[model samples]
Structures are given as structure tokens and as C-alpha cells.
Target: MIFAMVNVLAPIFAITLIGFVLGRSKIELHAGTLSTTVLLVATPALIFSSLTSYGVTPTMLLEMAAAAILCLSASAVLSMLTIKMFGLSMRSFLPSLMLPNSGNMGLPLVMLAFGDEGLKLGVSYFFFVALVQHSVGFSIASGSYSMSHLLKQPLIYAVAAVILVSTTGIAVPEVVLTTTEILGGMMVPAMLILLGSSLAGLTISDLRPALVVAVSRLVIGVLSALAVIWVLGLEGRVAGVVFLLSTMPTAIITYVFAQRYRPEPGQIASAVVASTLLTFGCLPFLLWFAVKVLEQS
Candidate 1:
């Protein structure tokens, strides 16, 4: 089990470490451009292709979506309660705990560990996650919701169009399909590199708040996902994906949102880096546990 887990994780970490090394060095990367391309182009393309591909059923998609929504909602509620109980500021902490880096880290790990079926479910879950992030999450961070921006995202349109076509049994053209697959293939590695680079830009100025938030986020988030899985009765690869996503570090986007709205971007940055570093110690056990539970189930 140890050997297999390491083998699966090594490649993923290798790519991320390369990005970290580059980020720490004198290399200059156009982060905004890379981020834009991944979010706007690669991600949507990946979503479309994965949804339209074979072996993805409406039932599976529905279950995955339900699990993701429940998990996210549960996380949000738990975070609110934690903030209230601990006297933490809502503006600074809620956003960090509410969002997970499921796209950049979750997707690639699922694909590597769980294979095509897992990727299919991961993409479905990520689709809803991104939706929640753009809509509800952005609203919370900005204190206002803009319908225009949400409507303007190509991801929404892509998801809608793909689901419509997929359910209707409409066949996409070979040329278009092939192009999407080729482009979508770029999503995972690109995201891994971006994650590493994003981490590179963060620093741990204060350890106390960072540790508290990181530990609480992981604990509450995992507990929420486990509760959702029990309530929803999800199992096998689906259950595994939910558990894995729940364990993801606080998203770097949390720091971006904090920079804009909250006064403590520094603490948020610390939490982001600290939580991500915590993953190295936590992920192996979590991965093993997921596999064992799925097998038993």
C-alpha cells in the first residue's frame, strides 16, 4: 500500500515541485496569462470533453454533483459556526475555509489515482465547484453578486451545451471532439504548475492564525464531506473523490479574494501555504484510507 501510494503520488509531486523550483528561481512567468488560459480555455475544454465522453452517465453525474454541493454547503455552514464560536472575523476566514483547490490539485490526483472513471466524476464535481466559486463565493468575497459576470463565463455555457448534447444523444463532430480532447489534455499539468507557482508567491508571516485556520479547515472540511457521503450513500470512486477533494488545502484564490476585500491578506497567505504544506503529511494516509474504504464498501 505504501509503495503503490508513493508511486501514484510521485509524478504529481514531481511536476508541482518543478514549478515550485522555477517559482523560487529567477524565472519570470506570466501568472495572469497562465491563469486565464487555464480557467477560460483549458478547464472548459476539459469539462466539455469529459462530459461528452463515453462511460459518463446522467446518474453518475447527478450523484457527483449532489455530493459536491452538499460538501460545499456543509463546509460553508461549518466555517460560519467556527468563526462565530471562536470569534474569528468572517471577512478573513470564511472564504478561505469555504473554497478548496479541487481543480488544480483534486482533478489531477483523482485522474492519477482513480483513472478515467474517477476523472469523469472529478470533472463533474469540479464543474459545480467552479460554479459555486464564481457565483456564491465571489458574492461572499465581493459583498455583491453580478449576474453579468457569471453569465459571461464560457464554462457555464460549455457545461450547459455539453450536458444538453450529451443527454440528447447528439454526436459531436470528430474534428471538434478531437480538438477539445487535445486542448483539454493540457489542463492537469498546467494546473499543477500553476498551483506550485502560486504557492511560491506566498509567505508565512504569522504562524498562529495560519495553523489554527489550516487545521480547522482540514478537520471541519473532512468531517463535512464524511457526513455528506453517509447521508447521500455515495461509495467506490465517487466516495473516494469526495473524500480527496475535502482534504485539499485552502485555495490560493482565497488569498486573492482576501487581498481585495479583507485586511489580512498576509495571514490568509500564511494559511494557504501552511495548509498546502500540511497536505504532504496528510495525503498519503488519506489516499490509503479512501482506497481501503472503497474496497471494503
Candidate 2:
């Protein structure tokens, strides 16, 4: 279990740390271009490549999607309770708490922990998380909803295409799969570097409230994932993927949303940094438990 945990987590830490070093060293990397490439190019390719090969029927895919939604709903409800208990403003904190870092931090962990089949399941979980993040999560953060923003994401079409081919029994060409698999390979490591760099640039002005939110996010995340998994009777790779993803740190993007649309951007930044630090601190133990205990569940 110890070896498994280290094997899974070491590359993530190293890649992210290199990004942090680059950010702090004042090197001029085109982070925006990289972000766009990941979003528009790599992400869609990843969705198509991994999910198309998932080997599950459309019904099973829908079941995974439903499971993801249940996990998110659990987090939202539990997050609201945490917010009210702490007297935090719902508008400022709800989106941040409800939306975990399922993309950058999540994919790598699942891929490493459970291999290809796990990546496929993790992609399904990520799809719904992204969907909710753009729709309901965006509304909560921005105080208004825009269908336009969600529609613009390429992964939507990517997933749609995957489902179309999957349900219709139309086999995708092998050349496309190989091409996409290559492109999809870049998504995780690039996102990790970007995540580390973005986090390194954030400044946390206050520690107390940040700690409060951080703890709440982690605790609610684990409890919510467990509750959902248990209630749904989810087990094996599906359960493991959902569990790891839900327990990820508060997404770095929450600060971006707060900066653009909500108040307390600085506080959000603080929470992002604090929560990430705390999550990583507890991750070895969390990983251990997942391998020793949750893996069998």
C-alpha cells in the first residue's frame, strides 16, 4: 500500500513542484496558450480517446454519470451545511466548496491508482463535474447562469460524439484513436504544471477563515463521497475514482471565478492555497486508506 501510494503520487508532486518553481523563478511561459491547448485540443481528445474505449454500454455510462451527479449533489448539500455552520456567505463559498479539482488533480490520481479502466471511469466522473461546474456551479459563483458559456466547451461535443458512436455501434477509425491518445497524454501533465504555477502565484492574506473553509472542504468532500458511494453501492474502480476526485483540494479556478464575478477573491485565493496545502498533507494517509480499506469496498 505504501509503495502504491508513493508510486501514484510522486510524479504528480514532482511535475506540480516544477511548475511552482518555474512560476516563482519569473520565467515567461505562455500559460494562456498552454491552457487553451489543454482545453480546446487535449481535453476533447482525451474525452474521446479514453471514453470511446471504455468498453461499457451506454446504460453503464449513464449510470456512472448519475453516480457523479449524486456525488456532486452530496458535496453541495454538505457544503451548504458547513457554510451555514461557519457563517460564511453562500455565494462566496458554495461554488468553491462544491466544485472539486476533478480535472487537473483528479485524472492523474485515478489513472495512476487504477490504470486504463480507472482513467475511463474517472473521465466519466470528470465529465459530469465539468458539466455541473459550468452550469449550476457557474450560476452560484457568478449569480447568473449562461448556457452560452457551457455550450462553448469543446468537451461537450467530444463527449456527444463518443456517446453517438458508442450507442450507434459505429466504430471510430484506429488512426483517430491513436492520434487522440497521443494528444490526450499531454492533458494531465500540462494541467499539473499549470495547476502548480497558478497556485504558486496566489497570495493568502488571512489564514483563519481560509483554514476554516479548507477543513470544511476536505471533511465534507470525504464524507460526501463515502455517503454517495455507500448509498449507491458503488465499488471497485468506479467507487475509487469518485472517492479520490471528491476529496481533491478546492479547485484553483474558484479563485478565478471569484475574481471575475464574486467578492472576496483574495479570500478565495487563500482558501485555494490553504486547502491545497492541507489536502496534499493528508493525501498519503488518504491514499493509504483508499488502498487498504476503500479498495475493497
Candidate 3:
């Protein structure tokens, strides 16, 4: 188990470190442009590869879809409760507090820990999360919902592709699949490098509030996930997968939204970094606990 954890976490940590070094080196890499490129090109390829390589099953698809809906609904309710309890202003509450960076951070972590099986679940969850991020998440972040932006996401296109392949029985061409595999291979390293670079700009003062948010996200998210899985009677790997997805740190995309709509970019950035770091400690324990519980049952 220890070895497995190390094997999974080492590469992610390494790539994140590289990103940090690059960011701190005073290099002129435009973080936004690089992030945009990842979103547009690398991410799509990665999603295509994952979906094609791990053919979706009816059970897997339905369970994952249900899980995604449940998780999002839970998150929305939690966010609203937090907003009211803390007396956060609309400007402060909308963008800074809601949504997780399920793409770059969450997906990679899932792939690392759970392999192809996890990837299948992660992709399905991501599709739903992306939709919520655009619709409910965007509405919270931007103070107004925009259907246009939500409808046009590349991630949505990827989901559409999955549906098309599943429903129509269309096989991806070998050449295209090969190309996607090659390009998709670069995504993890590139994403980690970006994450590390972003971290380079972080300071102690920036992390104080972020620490609080990170703890809240982890504790609340994990507990909620546990409750949902237990109630749903998920067992073994399925339960483990749900727990991992639930415990993922705040999404980096939250930073983009925060920058646009909220005043606490520092806090959001800190939350992203803090969660990324902390998950390394928390997720393994959660996985173990889930496995133990499922096994005992």
C-alpha cells in the first residue's frame, strides 16, 4: 500500500515541483496562455484517449452519471450554506468559494491512484462537474448565468463524443487514436509544470485563508462523499472511486473565475495550492478506509 501510494504520487509531485521551479525562475511563460493551451488542446486529447481506451460500460456510465449529479447537488448546497453562515458577500461568495478544479488536478490524481478504472469514473464525473461549473458554478461566480459559454466548452464536446461513440457504436480511427494517445501523454507533465509554476508565486500571507478553505473542503467533501457512498450501497472499487472524487482539492479553474469575478484571487490561489499539497496526505488514508470498510462488509 505504501509503495502503491508512492508510485502514484511521485510523478505528480515531481511535475508540480518542476512547475514551481519554472514559475519562480522569473521566466516569461504566460501562465494564462499556457493554461488556455492545456484546456484547448492537451485536455481534449487526453479526454478522447481516456474515453476510447477504456470503453464505457452501461453500468459504469449510469453509476458515474448518478454519482456526478449527487456530488454536484451536495456541493451546491454546501456552498450556499457556507456563504450564508459566513456572511460572505455575493462578490466574495460566487467565484471564490464554489467549484473544484476537477480537470487538471482531480483527473490526474484519479488516473494515478486508480489507473484505467479510475480514469473511466473520473471522466464521467468530470463531464458532469464541467457542466455544473459552467451552469451553477458560473452563475455563482459571475452573478449571471450564461448558457452560451456553457454550451461551447471543449469538455462538453468530449462528452458529446463519448455519447456518440457509445450510442452509435462508432470506433475511433487508429491513426486518430494513436495521435491522441501521443499528445495526451504530454498532458500530465505539462499540467504539473503549470501547477508548480503557479505555486512559485505563492506567499505565506496568501496561504492563511486558503488553509482554512482547504480544510473545510477536504473535511466536508470527504464526509459528504462517505455518506453518499454508504447510502447508495456502493462497494469495493466503486466506493473507493467515489471517495477519491469527493476529496479532490479545489479546482484551479476556480482561480480563473475568481480572477474574473471575485476580489480574493490570493485566497483562491492559496486554496488551490494548499489543497493540492494536502491531498497527498489525505487521499491515501481515505482510500484505505474505504477499502477496509467495503471489505468488512
Candidate 4:
């Protein structure tokens, strides 16, 4: 288990460390371009490629979506309870708790730990998480519900097209399929580098609140995933994927939102950093458990 954990996590950590070094060094890499490529080009391509190529049933895919929604819903309730219990501000803290870094960190972890099949499942989880983040998360942070924002995401359309083609048995052009597969292949490493880069640039001022949120998010997230799994009767790679993704750290983008809307961006920044740092300790155990679940299945 120890060897497996290290083998799985080492590459992710090394790439992220490279990004971190580049972030703090004199090199002038554009964060915007890298992020844009991951979000717009690589990720969408990956999604289309994975969905089209994956052999999982559509029923399984929908269940993954259902599982993701349940996980986020559980997280939201847990976040609200944590905030009320601690007397924390909602606008700043809630979004942080609710949104996990399922894109940059989650995708790579799934790919490394479980391969492309797991990547397909993780992408479903990510899709719903991003959807909820744009809809519910943005509304909480910005104080307005914007439907247009959700519609504008390219992944939305890509997901729809994939489903249509996949379910209908309509053959996609071989060239288009090959093209997406090639482009999508870049997503995992690029996002891992971006994760490290984001962490390198983060600024944390207070450790107290950050520690509180980080621990709560991790604990509550794990419990919630388990509860949802039991209730949904999920198992196999789907179960492992949900469990592993549930253990993911908070999204760094939460701090970006806090900086825009809230008074204490530093606290949010600290939470992001703390949770991500803590993930190094937590992920090994989570990965081991996920693999065990897969084995049992």
C-alpha cells in the first residue's frame, strides 16, 4: 500500500513541484494561458475523448452525476453547519467549503491512480462540481444567480454532444476522435503543473481559521461521500472514484472569489493552502482505500 501510494502520488507531486518552482522563480510563465488551455482546450478535448471512448454504461455515467450532486449537496449542508457553529461569514467561507479542486488536482489523481476509465468517471464528477460551482457557488459568492454563466461553458456543449453521439450510436469522424484523444491527453500533466503553480502563488496570513476550515472540509467531505455511497448503493470503480474525489482539497479558485467579494481574502487563502498541504498527508490513505475498494469489486 505504501509503495503504491508513493508510486501514484510521486509523479503528481514532482510535476506540481516543478510548477511551484517555476511560479516562485524568475521565469515569466503566463498563468492565464496555462489555465485557459487546461480549461478550454485540453479539458474539453479530454471530456469529449473520454466520454466517446469510454465503455462505461450511460446508466453508470448518470449515477456518477447523481453521486456528485449528492456529494456537493452534503458538502453545502456541512459547510453551512460549520459556518454557523463557528460564527464565520457565509459569503467568503461557504464557497470555499463547497467547491473541491476537482479539475487540476482531481483529474490527475484519478488518471494516475485509476487510469482512463477512472478519468472518465472523475470527469463526470468534475462536470457536476463545475456546474454547481458556476451556478450555486458563484451565486453565493456574487449574490446573484446567473444561468448565462453555466450555458457559456464549452464543456456543457461538449458533454451534450458526447452523450448524443454516444447514446445514439452515431459514428464520430475518425479524425475528430483521434484529434480529441491527442489533445485531451495533455490535460492531466498540465493541470497538475497548474495546481503547483497556483499553490506557489497563494498567500496565507492566518493559520487558525484556515486550519479549522481545512480540517472540517476534509472530515465532513469524507463522511459525506461515505454516506452518499451507502445510500446510493454505488460500488466498483465508480465507488472508488467518488471516494477519492471526495477527499480532494478545496479549489484554489475559492480564494479568487473571496478576494473579489469578501473582507478577509487571507483567511480564505490560508484555508486553500492548508487544505492542499494537508491533502499530501490524507491522500495516501484515501488512495489506498480507493484501491482496496476497487480490488474488492
Best by lDDT: 2
TM-score of each: 0.96, 0.97, 0.89, 0.96
lDDT of each: 0.84, 0.86, 0.71, 0.85
Model 4 residue 56 CA deviation in Å: 4.3
Instruction: In angstroms, give how far residue 202 of model 1 lies from its true place.
Output: 0.5
- Tens-digit lDDT string for candidate 2 (1-297): 678788999999999998899888869877778988998999999999988866656776787788788878888998998888889889889987888998988898888888998888888888888888878877888888899999998989998998898889998899999999999999999999998988888988878779988998899889988998899888776777888988998887788788998868999999999998898899887777665677776
Prediction-by-prediction clash tally:
0, 0, 7, 0
lDDT of 3 at 108: 74
> Ten consecutive residues with minimal summed lDDT in candidate 1?
53-62
Backbone clash pairs for candidate 2 read none
Per-residue accuracy of model 1 over 146-204 as CA lDDT, tens digit each: 99868877889878878788678888988888888999999999999988888898899
The number of clashing residue pairs in model 3 is 7
lDDT for 294 in candidate 4 is 47
